[model samples]
Structure formats: structure tokens, C-alpha cells
Target: MSTTLTLSTFDAPARPLNIPLPIDPPEGGWTWPPTSVTLIAGENDAVLIDTLPTVEDAADLADWIEASGKRLTHIFITHGHIDHYLGTAPLKARFPDVKVVSTAATAGIIAEEQKTKRDTTTYSAIFADDLVEEVVIPEALPADGRFDLEGHDIIGVSAGQSDTSESSYAWVPELSAVVVGDIAYNDVHAALIETTTPETRKGWIATLEEIQGRNPQVVVASHRKADAVNDAGALAKTIEYVELGDKLLSTDPRPTLAEFVARMVEANPTRANVTTAIYSGAVQGLR
Candidate 1:
């Protein structure tokens, strides 16, 4: 069964707009629904913001793209996270000629992670046991800059780090759209565990501000439904989430990171994963 969610575009000075791609995790051991893949249509070609988490999801997206009748010339990967990139192989297989764009750092990280995951017995057992022997590695990452797609341009920006060291961002000037990956999330709390320092959060905020400064018509986040945050509300929420993490880190001299996360979760029940990540990072720091 499939589900759909509609996100309305906001009217602001920048003219931000977005249509949310419905994604839910799969059942029985698989992360359900699926990550939303935003489609940014330019004058000539279309750019796929991010790939879903599985082959099935990628196939679904390909079907949608085919139905739209628009040429998908580029696939932009926001980061190296498995949830954001695992579906890439299928997409590449389907569109053998489309360029897969990302940062050099991100490409290296993805290649390393894919290699490690395929070789490690523990990782394979837990995540890919069903297809441990059928693992597929990705092709080379596109070099940074504007890649020609048919007659249009797809730009990959090395926007700097966020939750992960290799995080990257993409921009399409013609479409007035920016695919921010996990740099900016709406409604859901920010993931802090993957981030090493408050500096990383600051960098993320700075990047978002820069994107907004560009006044794009649409901004596509890696997770959550995509919508235009023309005003300050969505941005404010993002800042608030980061501030909350900082605040939690300030108080409580707890030694055990898990305990600290539990406390934070107690205070903010809605931010379970965010709290857990913060706790994990704190624990790692102590060690």
C-alpha cells in the first residue's frame, strides 16, 4: 500500500516552494515508509534530490519519474548516510547515464562505509543478512561543480559538515531549489549524535542561512515532508532544536551518556532519537 502527503508552498520574498514526497518505513525489520525524494524541475531537466533507503523505494521513484515524462539528468546525494543513499545503486542501474553528484569527502565516506558494511560480519548480520551475498557497490561520485544534464545544469556544493563529516548540499539555480539533505529538518527534532561538536550545529545553521540568503523558491530536506519556509517559523524551529541540544549538554554532569539521553528524553518525550544521539556523542566524548 502507498500513502501520499501534500505540502503547500509558502509565499515569501524568496518565493520558496516544495511538494512533499510521501515516505514511510517498510514493515518487519525494515525502516518503514521510506525517505521522500524531492523532484526539482528546471527549464530543461529535472534533478532528484535524494534516493530512498531501499531498492523497492528506488524503483518506485523511477516509476514516478518515468510517468512524469521529465528527463532525470542528475541524482544529488545530500550525505553518505545509508538511509539517504542505499537506494542509489538501483537508480543508477535504471538510469545508467545520469550523473551522481556529491562532495569528494562524502563520496569517499560512502565508498568506505559501503566497503566496511559489506565486509564486517556484524554489520552484514544485522542489516543485510537477507542479501549479504548480493551486496552492490555504487559507482564513482561526480566531481564537484556544475554538471550538464541535457541542456540544464546541476550544481553540487560542498556546503561543509553537519551531523556527518562528509555532508554535502546541492543547488539548482534554474529551478530555484536547494536539496539540503539532513542539514535542515522540519517538525522532527535534529539528530545530534552524529554531530561531534556545537560547532557542527553552528555550521549547519550557517549553511541554511546561506541557502535562504540565496532566496530559492524551494528547499528540500532529506527527511520529513518538504514545504516552503518562506517566513521564519521553520528556520526558528530548527534553531530551537539545536539550542535545546546545547541546553541539555550544559546541565547534568552525568558520566554515562545513555543516562543523560534518558534524562533529556524525559524532559522532551518527542525527541527520542535526537536525545539518544546527543547521549551517544557525549558518551563517546568522555571515552
Candidate 2:
């Protein structure tokens, strides 16, 4: 049988960001963007496309995978963001036979995240009890970024920058799916923590267009609404969101963090994690 794909979403609730912000959160406070983890299942084995963040969440994810009854042969990481890989060790412990892999650049970034304790220190303080303590770095994938499961090919496409640097995506040929970590955010605010300038924003759009050029039927975004459908349409939505961010930030006299957040909320009132996304942009992008 050909490979079939599925997803599990973790509805991570909004929490207070411990770091100081240019403006305070809305009355309702901030919520984190939900995470989506994909599973590509073949006849006898499966490949997990991404992992969740906290130990509790990963254990829950592990339970969900165990219920599927497919032997997980590999855990594929699409990027270096801590939220994408923090739960890896727990998953590794549960599926010891599964090999964890990512592009060499991603692996390098993962190492750097660990060395700098960016996640362990900052995120841990914010997430408090939800964060993972054990750090598990992945092995580097072959330079070509080709791997397989049950004879089907899964290639890693280079995504120069989206939310963060050294990002990449997983392309499954037989399934016509691309597991794009943060390259796209469906019905949610795009993470612009690292995407500041017009050039970088355009570059991100270029990368999304490149992924679109691949003509994949299924586009799995790492952060999305729990009920959002996976389809090629997300590519356009992400591109539009990035463009909106650039437009808002590029005014002759840029809006303050408060005005920026207010305008974003006005535009995307229904999008989840609006405060956190805008606050992140204010902190990183506005600087």
C-alpha cells in the first residue's frame, strides 16, 4: 500500500511571556499558536514528521501514535525551533528504535539552541511546567536530504528563513504532501520573531512559492488552528500574511508596538495567538 498521512494537533493554551514587552497583552492575555505534528504511515511502518514541545504533550502524542499501531521507524524534524524538537527525547525514549533526523543545517541549529540554552532557559521560564528538560539533538540527514519509509521517498527542501533561520521542510513524493514546519501558518499569526526586514519577508514569500512550485496537494503547517484543513491554499495565505506584516511595519512612520498589535488584531481578529505573534514581532522585528 502507498503511504497515507495524518496529523495530531496540540492546542497549547496562551500563557504569559516572561520577557518584558513594549506593550502589555490584551485583557484576555496571550496564547501560544497550536502545533500540528504529522504522521506518514506506510503499510508496516510510519514516519513522524514533527514532534511537540512539552514532555506532557509529547507523552500524549506518543500515546496517540501508539494507538495507530504503525511501527514508527523515524522521527523527522523540519526545522530548528525549540517548539518543533523539544519533545524529541521523550519520543525517542518511547520509540527507541526510531532514528531522529534533520538536515545538517537544522542539526547545527539544534546544537546551537542547546549550547545557548535559549529554549531551556527562556522558554522554560515562560512555559514553566510544560517545557521539556532533556535535550535530544538529531543526526544530520544526507546532503541530498533524501530519506525513505517503506520504499517511498521523503525529501527535505531547503527553506532559507521563515520565523527562524536554518529552516527546512519535508516533501513526500508518493503522498503529494509537504510538511512545512513554520514556512506556513494556517488561520494563525505568522511567527515573525526572526523575519524583520522587507528583504527577509520577500525571501520568505519566495521560499513559500518554491514549495508551491512543487505542486504538493497537502501542506502541513506546524502552527495552525486545530480544525484547519491541510491543502495547497495555505501557501497563498501564508504569503499574504507575510505581505501584510511587511506593509504594516513599513509605514513612513512605523506604528508603535501597541498600534501594530491593534492593527493586526483588527485585520485577523479570529486568528489564534494574535497577541504573542504581534508581541514577538514587536520585540524582534521592530528592533
Best by lDDT: 2
Give the local distance difference test score of model 1: 0.55
What TM-score do all the candidates reach, one by one? 0.69, 0.92
Misplaced by over 4 Å in model 2 are 1-19, 284-287
lDDT (10s digit) by residue, model 1, range 26-129: 12322221135676654446667667653455566777777766666777677777656666777777777776767676677677766777433333343431
Model 2 residue 110 lDDT?
86
Q: Which 10-residue span in candidate 2 carries the lowest summed lDDT?
A: 7-16
Q: Please estimate how well model 2 matches the true structure, expressed as its whole-model Cα lDDT.
A: 0.79
Error of 1 at 97 (Å): 2.0
Best by TM-score: 2
Count of clashing residue pairs in every prediction: 12, 1
Residue 199 displacement (Å), model 1: 3.2
